[model samples]
Target: MKPSFFSQYWCMVSQGWKADLADKERLITPLLFAITVLLLFNFCFEEVSKGIEGQVFTAELYLTTLFALQMSYVRIFVPDQQDKVFSLLQSYPLNYSAWFLSKYTLALLYSLLVFVPVMLLCGLFFSGADLNIWSAELWLGGLLSIIGLSTLGILLSTLTLKASGREMLFPLLYFPLAVPVLLASVQASLSFLTSVPGGWHWMGILAGFDIIYFTLGVLLFGELVTAV
Candidate 1:
């Protein structure tokens, strides 16, 4: 009999964690890239007002998260893809939903690690932005947006897995699909400064995107992985 879904999921996550441990650089790269992008944004607009700064940084945070997720998605299946191990794994009677969940979980963890610290840093530098960084709405919006981004990331990563010029192809596919989610993230965050009700609406949109992308991933990942 096949392992239970939880059993399969834990096993995949454990292996993924081990791979991350072995390649420390892979784990660090996205965090470093996010910070670098935020730093550049700071330098470019050093004289902007607190309100404008709040909006700019809020937008930057999600944009950085999106780019960082792209970096991570590239490696989501690297371990199994290497050495024909993917084929061996596919031969087993595994649960594909569990497989999708594990990859999504890994990507979500990486995105939070990359996003939260940078978000705190932005709060520190632009405290006058009047957007309460610690607000529940802001955090919820960030979480929902990251969920949507990770969902798209995994699906696109697999879609381009065997294609030529994947590095170039991924961004072409990712950015277009990710734009609406990223926009909702930024709006959800910025709305906190203007109107509480508006913030919730944006968060709802973010959640809707997450649901759509996640459903697509669960349905398509099995076929995408097994395709010739």
Candidate 2:
């Protein structure tokens, strides 16, 4: 029997999700990096705790989480192209747009999987800070950031597929493109931390970025995939 369209798309997402979970090296690297960064911040900032304001530790933690999520997108797509698996998947019955969206969905879900626990742990360590400000707006902003980053990553992954030095190329390409999202996220996060009323505008900016990038990605990705 033929699979339904939704079933086929979800199968693509599930395959991507499982591929991520099963790759212990790829999976653990980000988590360890995040923990190490957090611990280093904790120790490094110990003496300056009194001088620090605005939950600097929490800000660092959020930055670490975002960085890890960005790395995971690299890991997921780069290896698939290296092994020619992405090309094979592209040849399948699923529409290329569905495949792209499925990967985006997987990346977003995987990022949340890593982010939530890290945020909670950071909350525990930084007592007296109202971590409860992780509000609906914050969630929306995060999702937008993820969408924007993942779209960009997908585009770059295709571009760098055959480069001999893609590992180096990935960060060089990713970080510059990611600047806007990171800035918007930081602003939104600061608004959340400060209990400011106008923070939602930052979230709106993030949402707008997501919409613009996702649309651009969908349009540009066909050319990207076919170019190689």
Candidate 3:
């Protein structure tokens, strides 16, 4: 008899988590990429920084995470495919929602660790930017934004699961789909930085984006992973 759906979900999560532990080097790509993006943005927007009332640093924090997470996420499923373990999984009665959430969790954890501290440092030190970088609201909003972005990334990943040019196709599919997350994240971060009145509204919108994608993932992941 087949395992229960919840049991299959847990099994897939454990499998994915253990696999990631053994291949710890894969974690480096997102971390390094995130740092590089933050630095590059800080430099690229140096002139713009002078005009954004130093909210530039906050912009760097969230916007850079937005793009960097998407860029690094294309590789989230590559290792599974390269080893052909997903083929092995196909033999089991596994739910693709499990697969989706497991991948999303790992990617989000790495992105949070790398982006949050650097963003905090910038928020504290960047001149003219007045933000309570230590506030729970900011952290929570950042977390929600990452979650929203990861949800969209996983959805795109599933769509491109078999595409030959996934690297080229992913961004093409991802950026347009992810615009809501991107926009709400920027607005939420800007509100946090400037103490504006409408931050929660954008946060709520980010959370809504997360909910929509997550629901779609649960509903559609089965067909997505099963497609030829």
Candidate 4:
């Protein structure tokens, strides 16, 4: 009898976690890069006017997240590829949707791991003593954007898995497609920080993008993997 989808998904997620944990650098490298970039920005802009500083800080935060997330994206398939596990998986009549979900879940968790610490550190660096940065609205915007980005990342990673010069190809492909999500994320974050109206509008856009990317991922991932 075949394992149920949930069981398979849980198993895949477990394996992915184990693989990530085993090679701790896969998670730590991007995080260190993010912090380094943030520190560089802070040092360079420490003297900027307070009014412009917030805007600059917001841009830096999202840009750092984007760069770090993209760095992590390539590793989504690396463990399976290196271990030839994809071949074994292909031999089974397993559900690719579950596989995609497991990968997507891993990507989401990985992004969160990179995001939360950066967020806290960003707040500490950029926020006023009276400013409360961890509002419910900010969390909603960040999570929704991460969801959309992770979905797209999985699809794109799968698409480029077997391509020549994929290292060169991924950023060429990922950043342009991710512009909408990144923009919405930045705008939503600004709205939340400034207590401005229309924060929901940006979050709604992020949600819409997430649905579209996830739907495409589910429909196309199996075909792509089988072709590899």
Candidate lDDT values, in order = 0.84, 0.72, 0.73, 0.87
Q: Which digits, one per residue and each the tens of the lDDT, describe model 4 over residues 14-101? A: 9999998999989789899999988998888776675565467579888999999999997789888887888998998778999999
Q: What is the TM-score of each candidate against the true structure?
A: 0.95, 0.86, 0.87, 0.96
- Candidate 1: which pairs clash? none
- Scored against the true structure, residue 98 in model 4 reaches a CA lDDT of 94
Q: Which candidate should be chosen as best, given TM-score against the real structure? A: 4
TM-score of candidate 2 to 2 decimals: 0.86
CA lDDT, candidate 1, residue 95: 89
Candidate 3 vs candidate 4: which has greater TM-score?
4
Q: Which candidate is the best by lDDT?
A: 4
In model 2, which regions exceed 4 Å deviation? 1-4, 47-52, 130-134
Q: Which pairs in model 4 have colliding backbones?
A: none
- Model 2 pairs in collision: none
> Model 2 over residues 128-171: C-alpha lDDT tens digits?
65444556766666666777777777777667766778889988
| Model 1: residue 5 alpha-carbon error in angstroms | 1.6
lDDT over C-alpha atoms for residue 90 of model 2: 66
Q: What is the lDDT for 188 in model 1?
A: 85
Summarize candidate 3's per-residue lDDT along 135-196 as a digit string, tens digits.
Answer: 67777877887787777777788788888988899989887887888788778777776678
* Per-residue lDDT of 209 in model 4: 89
